[model samples]
Target: MTLFWAGAYALTRVAVDKGNPDMGLPVAWVLPGRLTIGAAVLWVLMLARGQKLPPLRDRKRWVAIIGMGLAGSVFPFFLITTAQETVNSSLAA
Candidate 1:
């Protein structure tokens, strides 16, 4: 997890740096693509391990899951991506 987290910042920096007038790749596109790919990979791994999806009918569970996703995943990614626009990736990390 630590290594993956570090690598994410480094790779995000690379992506941002590579963006220019010609390429015009925004952080908006990059961040969601990264998240989607990560989620897909995790879903595949869970399936490979024979993991079952939890019941979505449970409202409280859904709330907690959403909260965690926003707090743990989405928020941090947005913050980092926004910061990386000005801050050095190494410093951001």
Candidate 2:
């Protein structure tokens, strides 16, 4: 976990560095791509584990799930990667 986080911080730092225009990925592209791939992998794993989402009709539970996902998962990563654009990896992480 430590290594992965370190790498993520380091890599996003490089990726979002606009000073190196030729080598850097666009900031707009990185977050969504990372999130989409992560979501895909998680979906596969959940299926493999025989897990299922709460029914769509369970509106409160569904809302809670979405809210927690946005707050806990997506928001933090978004903030970290965006911050990485302006600061050193260690500082951003």
Candidate 3:
């Protein structure tokens, strides 16, 4: 998780450096795209390694997953990238 967050921060800083003031990427790729790709890669790795994923069958687990996705996934995805748009990665850290 730490590594993932660090990579997200790095990606956001780099993407921001290449994007516009509006945080728009006129090109084919963007920060969110990169983050999605990273997630996909990690998911694939976990699957290949036969790692057990979160059980979303339970109501409580579902809620936890939703909360985690919103808090740990989506929130950081936007915040880190947007922050990187204006601040240096080291300073943001």
RMSD of 1: 2.1
- Evaluate residue 59 in candidate 1 and report its C-alpha lDDT on the 0 to 100 scale: 88
Tell me which of candidates 1 and 3 scores higher on TM-score: 1
Tell me the TM-score of each prediction against the true structure.
0.83, 0.82, 0.62
Clashing pairs in 2: none
Q: Which regions of candidate 1 fall more than 4 Å away from where they truly are? A: 1-3, 18-24
TM-score quality measure for candidate 3: 0.62
Per-residue lDDT tens digits for candidate 2, residues 1-93, read 789758877878877884565677776788888878879999999999999988899999989988998998788988887777667888886
Q: For model 1, what is the error of residue 26's alpha carbon versus the real structure, in angstroms, after optimal superposition? A: 1.4
Candidate 1 local Cα displacement, residue 80, angstroms = 0.5
lDDT at residue 24 of model 1 (Cα atoms): 34
Regions more than 4 Å wrong, model 3: 1-8, 18-31, 52-57
Q: What value of lDDT does candidate 3 attain over all alpha carbons? A: 0.68
Show the lowest summed lDDT stretch of 10 residues, model 3.
Answer: 22-31
The prediction achieving the highest TM-score against the true structure is 1
* Native-to-model Cα distance after best TM-score fit, residue 39 in candidate 1, in Å: 0.5
